[model samples]
Target chain A: MTPASPAEPTNPPLTRRARRRNQLVAVTGLVLVWVLLWGSFTWANLIGGLLVAVVLLTVFPLPPVTFAGRIRPVPLARFWSRFLRDLVVASVQIAWLALRFGHTPRSAIIAVPLRVNTDLNLTLTAEALSLVPGSLILEADRRTGTLYVHVLGVRTLDEVQRFRRDVLDLEARIVAAIGSSEERRRVTGADPAGPPEPTRLEGTPT
Target chain B: MTLDAVLDIVAAGCLIAGALLSLAAGVALIRFPDLLSRMHAAAKPQVLGLLLVLLGCALRLRTGVDITTLVLVGVFQLATAPVAAHMVGRVAYPHDEIRRDLLLTDELAAHIDRIRADRTDRPEVSDAASAPGRG
Candidate 1:
């Protein structure tokens, strides 16, 4: 028989206080959404939204996905700026590529090893990567913390390595911004003397 | 031009650009070779295009409620689109919908094979190992 591996719940169970807080946030969000959909903020809309929120929460609670990450201002600012820059740059590049139908750019599905292990980190990194125009996540094996990404416009091995580095850098920034202290330590400890360096693939040129 | 005129021009630009991006996504969907690549056409440009369209809506409506709603729609789209894409990708991979030739490194296939071998050696443990939830 396969040894019964320790069954770790995908999301840590929430405490009573945390549950209350989540409910409050959910209610407020629903009310705001209600007002927006109506294009007006009135007492009736607010009350209706609150009622709906309560009913929804009671009837169908969200799956127990833990929200454990905390925001670090400096790293978050850096991450946002980088993300926005990449957004614009990638959009333009993909748009241009698509319009130039004369030449078919080479594309490939490459595996990316992720150092960040938490569910939140994995989700955020995958989402961020997919949002960028040229790259999309083809498969995420949480079992191995590996992401298979389909990337456009990669014609050379150098470009592949560059893509890998970019992904690792993105993960590091995410770990810096919101990762738990242990995660932060692991990231920094990997490169003790200087900034966290991306793991280089063997045989890839420096 | 007056400030109102400027806002109108900017909003018009956003709307036009967003429409064009959506058009590109459609074209790519048709032209791309396989399921995996076709997904690239289906997802990326569509989200950005929706975002641009939302921005234009916010600019044109200029009311607090409308702007708030538009922003929320964009946020929810940003949060959900990738997840949907991921789910589709996951299903496609196992079903062999992917064109194997386009892959440079298929770590997933190797990983699955290794797990399968391990399971075959110890049949009793295979159920838990193959289950969808994390280990």
Candidate 2:
């Protein structure tokens, strides 16, 4: 079997403006970490963090992580609210499953074909799924943008379809929030259509 | 009761719940059947538990300094945990650690096969087709 090629460029050169922005973002994050470690946000800590951040950025310049999408606040807000609600719901579901102890929860790994092909979209969707209690991404085929996710409590095919639809819904929300116009159109266009066809391999029964 | 007393009770509840969730995570890690399933146990509750504990600590401390640190801890944990779990899951799949019977579909295998055929059809592109992190 051939392995999946890495989607990310190893060291793609960044534009001058992009480089500056990357450095600024990194510095800001580092400075925040510094202040947190110091357990204060006084002038002294802020100044110290700033100096350290600048020095760190200058000394060790990292390859720029390119995001081909811009943030749309409305969609972003929608995503967050829905995510928060799902987090609570999933946690309660897991807690119930844990408490039930007697019944063996039937779990299955379902392959979901992703329409959103960008690295950022794929990564975000996987992270979101993994954060939720019931599902976790087992493997991602970068070649086809397919995610193999192990989901708890899927006994029937209908439940499997529902899980797949949930993933697609999340991807749509994410694309709407930060994806480019082309990505947004693709997602929107595919909405009326059914779920993307996923490649299936027969599993041998134990 | 007074506001401070009420806050203290809420914080205590958060801490207790967080601790219990973490305890449940440990149990699931051992009790789950296979590698991928166990990873769900390993990743989810642990993160939520940590977030709750951090929230409790932040509420109890209430100062600018302690709260900042707690916020940082929660943010970083939320950002990093899923990525780590993804990496673990990715590694487990190629190694056949996941139970085959438990998987309803194996799209990854199909994708790999397609890639292999495509590579075989064009020998010159083999170098480019060679996936990173695998021999």
lDDT accuracy of residue B60 in candidate 2: 86
Regions of model 1 farther than 4 Å from truth = A1-24, A191-206, B95-97, B112-135
Candidate 2 lDDT by residue in tens digits, A1-206: 33222222222344567656767888889988998888866899999999998887666655345565689999999998888777766666666666666755677767776676655677889988887758988676555666778788677767887888888889889999998787788777845545555644455333
Worst ten in a row by lDDT for model 2 chain B: B126-135
lDDT of 2 by residue, B1-135 (tens): 998888888999999989988888777777766777767766778887888898888778889888877888888887888778877876676666766666555556655456446545775432333222112
**Candidate 1 lDDT over residue span A31-146, tens digit each:** 77777777777899889888888788667555434455677999999998898777766666666766777766666666776666556777889999987757888765554566
Lowest-lDDT window of 10 residues in candidate 2 chain A?
A3-12
Q: Compute the DockQ of candidate 2.
A: 0.33
Docking class of 2: acceptable
Error of 2 at A69 (Å): 3.2
Interface RMSD (Å), each candidate? 6.5, 4.8
Prediction 2 global C-alpha lDDT = 0.72
